[model samples]
Target: MYFGASASALQRLVEQLKLEAAVERIKVSQAAAELQQYCMQKACKDALLVGEPRSCALF
Candidate 1:
């Protein structure tokens, strides 16, 4: 029973990680879209976008 439970838990954990990674990709793409929109606005206002921009660097 313990072995079965352990295997089940491990399978669930793997599934969760896969889901999280998929969600992370969605989030990073969203963030990049937002960042691009922001930079475009900033550029329009200042002619040169500048700042310690946010990172969307994935693991």
Candidate 2:
């Protein structure tokens, strides 16, 4: 009975870790997307400032 309880606890811990990792991955993905958007906007604005053509493919 003790061994069974230990196994159950270990399984729960593993599942919790997996959930935490998934959450972290989602957060990182969102941050990356936001950063990409900011970069694209900055690039387009810089191009306009320098009198370059506003042909940004990201937009």
Candidate 3:
């Protein structure tokens, strides 16, 4: 019974890792798109207002 529970826990861990990896990939893709947009636009003060804290703005 103990062995079975250990195996089941391992399986759950593996599945969670797979899901985390997929989430990471999605975030990277979104960041790439945001960066591309930031680059294509001007870096004027108006653009700086786009993202937040002002300084964190990409454009």
Which regions of candidate 2 are displaced past 4 Å? 1-5, 25-59
lDDT of candidate 2 at residue 15, scale 0 to 100:
100
lDDT of 1 by residue, 1-59 (tens): 44657877988988998998887455878999999998877785552344445564574
Worst 10 residues of 2 by lDDT: 45-54
Q: Model 2 lDDT vs. the true structure?
A: 0.78
lDDT of residue 7 for candidate 2: 75
Q: Which residue runs of candidate 1 sit more than 4 Å off their true CA positions? A: 1-5, 24-59
Q: Against the true structure, what is each candidate's TM-score? A: 0.33, 0.33, 0.33
Task: Note the residue pairs that clash in candidate 3.
Answer: none
Query: Each candidate: what lDDT?
Result: 0.73, 0.78, 0.71
The TM-score obtained by model 2 is: 0.33
Error of 2 at 35 (Å): 17
RMSD of each: 10.0, 10.0, 8.4
